[model samples]
Target: MSSLSKLAYYLLHNHSRIAANLVEQGIKEMNIKIPDEEKDHAVCVYETFFQFMGDSLEQETNEIPSKLIEWSKKNAEGQIFSGGKISEIIIRYPVTRKIFADLSTQWAEEFSLTNKESIKILQKMNAMLDVSEVETVFAFEKLTKQMKKDYQKELDTLSNPIVPLKEGIAVLPLVGTIDSYRVNHLMEKVIPEIAHLNLNYVIVDFSGVQTFDETTASYLQQIGSVLRLLGIRTILTGISPQLAQIAVAIGAEFHDVTSYTNVKQALENI
Candidate 1:
């Protein structure tokens, strides 16, 4: 089918649902609407918006452009509620499209990047497309940033050696989410830091960490074991009840891992 014909078919079948969902989301985010006179512009934008989302279903999860997020935020802040219905239609279509694209990419690759997994992820994305755009965007932004930070941290850990420290101690302050990628990064950094500083203790502070899953907790458990092998002590700090639950769920036992409630507390114990 021709692109235009396919788009028209989609709109004919899905416009009401799309428009109502997007408008409601925009209202919650910034209190906006589409004016009756500007409905044509809104429809045009929505059509373009759907095309973008459809295309994104096939892309990699970590490839969202930051420009889209900035532009959507700008549109919402400037015209969510005040530009009448014209603003509603004009702004929401693009904003919703970006959100759809972000969620589509995230869900599509949360497990694997194969075709089968991608299709399942797409279904989940469609379900969430009706949620608030503002909240969705917020989560997308936060998650993407954490992913990027984890990536950069890995690169840094691999390329650089730890600086020497006195008192045979080194501290690595961890903020945000922790995943397998981050666990590998920490492992790289810790070994080199231990060798370079000749340190017997390495403290990892989870004070700013928002979430920790099984992979991360298991990584922590392994780190403690590895450090003991090297005759170094691993100190874990900032263990929240939620993280504790995750640790248990993952069968990650910290019984052998030296842990504390916070960095300060860990230091005192050290």
Candidate 2:
């Protein structure tokens, strides 16, 4: 029983018309009715409830717990006007908070998510309130698993950071989302592979990639940039027009990257 709820109870029960008239007049709460000593205790109860309602409405958007007991002690003659009447009032307020709480709990349980995931869910809901995309939500879950697997592979590759290719020619397969994490791993793995295999050329195959975005294009450029510095030629394969468009859009410098459509084509040219 929060003060806001208590206040709402009294407002609706006693001055029910006040709620309607307030909406008409754009008034959140009516003026408080302070009771005279000669008047009935019911009058005092109503006055106290009115004032409390106003104050509760004032603090509507905040999450502060109600200091209602302290308030009742200071304002009313006998701390709080408690009886069967007041008990009935306690159960009378709107059940909006209950509804919202249930909705939130449902979403949390559905996702089995916490903290950042909750924030992301809230943000997505806020952004796409009307445009319900069920498939997009399903895709996000699937991609989350793929992203986790990609991250694990990155960690393992970083531990060794170098894979020797057949006949001392290394093949560094670039797959999944190519964010900064993958680019950093590429830097770590590239030079070591070049040195360990005594390789003159490293074939960076992008054939298995499902999507090509600017981030991935930039990462490819970064790989080529570093490999050139290590005195190793980087032969990029599977450069789709979409990939090239992304590279152009981001102004990714791919001048030195000798590209082929696939590994066999790259090998023939090398």
Candidate 3:
């Protein structure tokens, strides 16, 4: 290992407690509160810093591995479990990175390092922070996808409602595009909700739906058949000409399902 890496390894390993204390100070400088739910999480954050710097200094090339990126991701996942907000990673930690960088320069200067040594120390410090920042973003993006999926599922349940109008009668209004995801939700979530409603008659209104693919149209046709097997009578409403054409083109068997022009007309006529 280089002289610089050796010096770093000595400081990080022998003086780990001091380094961890400095990390906590840097975090406090950001004014980011460590909530009670995530109390132990604060310790993990500092411990992660110690491990990363110590391990990087131990390595010969001064280069961190890709799997070592998991170090950052694991810390982030801990934050979630510990009640640390995602904003802490995105907003607060950038400030902490700057603080840690400043501390590294001060330490190098205090050690009376030459200009060459000082530059090498800063370079190593920058390299470590760069990896952490990049990996943290990847972990945050994963959290965002999971969070969005859950929110969308809630919104879907709200938007595609199964409203009970009267005894043994319910209306399900489908709006917007019908994709495979929506089809699966209909069969899974909506079907169960329909069953729980204990309605003998269900009015599946499609007037608000703008478009649907062949697969979606075929799935829609199956809704009536599935309900009929459960002894519920399903009357389809708001069949736009485009939807009708798509249904016919897909060779979907809709002969057994009854159709009405609109929800209002279906309610009045049925």
Candidate 4:
């Protein structure tokens, strides 16, 4: 067999040992510790990586193995789910790359491979690592974005909650700074939820609100209009002087809606 073929054969046969050695050397060089239980899994990952490397060398192709790409995405998802930072995995890459390069050179020497052949192997290894890194980062970003969206949806549901006061009365206590996002959330989600409650009255209390602006006043007017159309009486409570001025400035007429000083008074009157 040719020297290149022999080298490929050796790599395929010794991949497990090479992977173990790489892991051991990597941990020591990076001064990082892996838990005893996790050590086996780490070695297994490296073993699969090395096996794929051998396959690439044997085929003389630069194309990365599909198994490795799938593994990278799955690993990224696992890191996110386990509350582990992607940086933790990324920080070790430089050292890992160095170790792999050194091992490739050592193997080339041992097998008496030509410099051209050595460079080919090293280039293929680097290409595979690059693909793995990109796949991992892409997966991490996609999953993190989805998680944030889901978390915001949950917060919106909690923030705009409709607390039933009585048989036909409910309160929507607006807290925090009012923004366009919150207003849109109310228009889309809260309005439908309120409609389903069969409530005759809804107290929109703005006492806990930190700031009121012209935009918020307009949104409030819109909400009041929708509630009125549903035959639900709208009660405005906790309207500070500042909020009242802003509503008037924005031309948000509340003449048809009932006004009260606070929730207790609104409840008493209702």
Listing every candidate in turn, what is its Cα RMSD in Å to the true structure after a full C-alpha superposition? 15.8, 20.3, 6.0, 2.7
Give per-residue lDDT, candidate 1, residue 180: 83
Model 2 C-alpha lDDT versus the unseen true structure: 0.51
- Per-model TM-score on C-alpha atoms: 0.41, 0.40, 0.62, 0.86
- The residue pairs found clashing in candidate 2 are none
Task: Order the candidates by TM-score, highest first.
Answer: 4, 3, 1, 2
Cα lDDT tens digits for candidate 1, 1-270: 533234335545665566556545555665554465445444444544444444444332323334334444544444433532333434554565565566446534443355655555455444433333554456445655666787787665654344334488777777677778767876876565566667888786776678877667777778778778888887778877887777778787778667888767776776
lDDT of 1 at 46: 51
Number of the top-ranking candidate, with TM-score as the measure: 4
Residue 270 error, candidate 3, Å: 1.9
Between 1 and 2, whose TM-score is larger?
1
* Reference-based lDDT, each prediction: 0.58, 0.51, 0.73, 0.85
Per-candidate clashes come to: 5, 0, 0, 0
lDDT of 3 at 124: 68
Candidate 1 lDDT trough over 10 residues, lowest sum: 58-67
Off by over 4 Å in 1: 1-166
Which is superior by TM-score, 1 or 4? 4
Off by over 4 Å in 2: 1-166, 212-216
- Rank by lDDT (best first): 4, 3, 1, 2
